[model samples]
Target chain A: MSKKPVKGEYIETDTGNKVSRRSQIIGTTNIILGGKTVIQAEVIIRGDLLRTYTSSNPGEKQGNPVAVAIGRYCFFSRGCELRPPGKLYKGQFSHYPLKIADHVFIGPGSIIEAALIGSHVNIGANCVVGKFAIIKDYVRILDGTVVPPNMVIPSFSIVAGRPGRVVGEIAEGEVDGMDLREVYREVRN
Target chain B: MSNKRQSMMPPAPKPPTSLSSSIVIAEHASLTGTKLIMIGSNTVIHPRAKLNSAYAPITIGSTCIISERSQIGILKEPEDEEEAEPVVIENGVVVEVGAIVEARRVGEGSVIEVNARIGKGAVLGKHCKIGPLCEVAEGEVLPDFTVIFGNGMRRIDNSGVEDLKMKMVARQVEVLRKLIPSNIAKFQ
Candidate 1:
């Protein structure tokens, strides 16, 4: 078993703003925070760890922000991580931002970096949305479920698991879909 | 001759883990000597945090964020099973809101998502992501920068990404920090 890393010890690149131990901020990988977005601590922007997208919007930031575009009246709980779109690369490191549509609810400890999330999405607590995964509007990701990279979740669906399979389609304003264990298979190589 | 004996005294009992000012315990939490907590500078423990370790202590690195409503505890040994070891979360790691990590070691810069449960002696690599509400079984090792979200699961060891009985979610581009789990097996 390996140990966890220290927070203050690492250094960030010259580009983005500093991420304090526990604070909220907006950054590229494509972040569009709604005018009234209220985010709490343990929140993170999943910028391109690989620098995959082109962030050359000439200050406008063409690449994805960690959050693409948050709508008004959005509340992000603690421990949320957002991944934006960036330049895609075969191997070379590029950068992109996350694209979040309007009116999304990101629960605590949720990770949505480098993905395309549509409007009115309610991501449950501790749900992990992979890079480049497209989630349409009204999608509810259950707690502790995993969304694979580059996968597309049709709108109004509920997903849960190690590799989260779509348990069922969520009705309008509906929560609670399928059993996490039944939908997702245990992660095996 | 009896007066000289006054100089001899037994060592003091350790302060309860919650009382150690060296470590920051969040509000609405209780800690005791049964738990050991080692945290780096500027690490914040949110309200309603609870760490109970009869088997081992909870260690966190500097500038890390342990979110609210989180329960970090040691797992009891199963019937006929030897006592398990302590849970160690290294520097720069983020234990997201409502996440539960009960393991030997979680690597630096790794993110354990909300409501995630890590089993005994599981080692996660640096910059890795253990997605929300996921459960990683014991004796699993994750390499650096690997993303374990969305059913992406793999195991690690001395040799690189060889296929195991376990399924790997995905290994990212970055390298995780190299660290060995602190040996707490003898404490029991």
Candidate 2:
């Protein structure tokens, strides 16, 4: 079951994105990983679930088909899954793109199906951010939290529980700790 | 240590019978064990999705989406039973990421959400939705349109939207067929 290790554990991209060799990332053409992102081992990013429904607006320029878009300095821990959420819209079943901004730290074993995750967010281990959920900037989702589908979590909030509820707010002093630059640097082969 | 771990692992998966020509089974998907496994057309089996039929056979119908890390089939035979029951996943079922399904039968259009566990011998009816991280006890039977959510809360969804949901599953499968590169030949 074991293959010979040809090189280092991670393949660092030209843009400085460090992707683990053991990561199961499908449909690489449809995934956009901004520079300085670290994808740990056993992570499954489903970039194959691209949007199929075409927009009716003729004048609007067609954007590149992307299933998942991640910004810089993001850390996706081991065993986490990033899936684009799908639903029936106007009689067409289509998957929407999942977007994540910079400095986002997603803990291990979390399954994220959220539509948008803003900057400086920290999601704890075993959390499930449901489909179409919008998480704004500076949010901290506690461990084992199950954020329900379509739930919107505003900025500076701490969310927890099964059907995750906003339990508290993050203070201004605590927000600085959410930066993932240090975390990214420490993840060595 | 690595050699010892590899020795403990199960034998290489035997190829399943009756895999349709149009099914999209990824090259990395693990089809394991030593029993008959049948998959219908347009079903998308993502990478790392496991179909373990060592204890019993597994039958998956058309347009089903078995996501990554999800395990289908029973882990072991029951102590009291002489033979293990086969797992039957009906048409249009979506077993999401990391879910472990050991169900006796999962009816059509059911959605087993991420990390959900359907215990051994559980029977899920048509259009049933098991929420993320939820657990269905072994041998439990759920009725049609049952929505099992937060902390084991139960509700019947007679919302008249079952047709739309099924259509969505079909469309998702259609899109997946074009996106996921299938290695059906390897599995066959």
| Model 1 interface DockQ | 0.11
lDDT of 1 by residue, B9-95 (tens): 764344244222333343334343465666665455544455666667777666455655566767564455565666777766667
- Top candidate by DockQ: 2
Over A105-183, each residue of candidate 2 has an lDDT whose tens digit, in order, gives 9999999999999999999999999999999999999999999999999999999999999999999999889988888
TM-scores, each model vs. reference: 0.46, 0.92
The runs of at least 3 residues in candidate 1 whose Cα sits more than 4 Å from the true structure, single-residue gaps closed, are A1-23, A26-31, A46-68, A85-88, A170-189, B1-117, B122-132, B136-188
User: Lowest summed-lDDT stretch of 10 residues in model 2 chain A?
Assistant: A1-10
DockQ of each: 0.11, 0.75
lDDT of 2 by residue, B53-149 (tens): 9888999999899998999998876687567889999999999998999999999999999999999889999999999999999999999999999
- Ten contiguous residues with the weakest lDDT in model 1 chain A: A180-189
In terms of TM-score, the best-performing candidate is 2
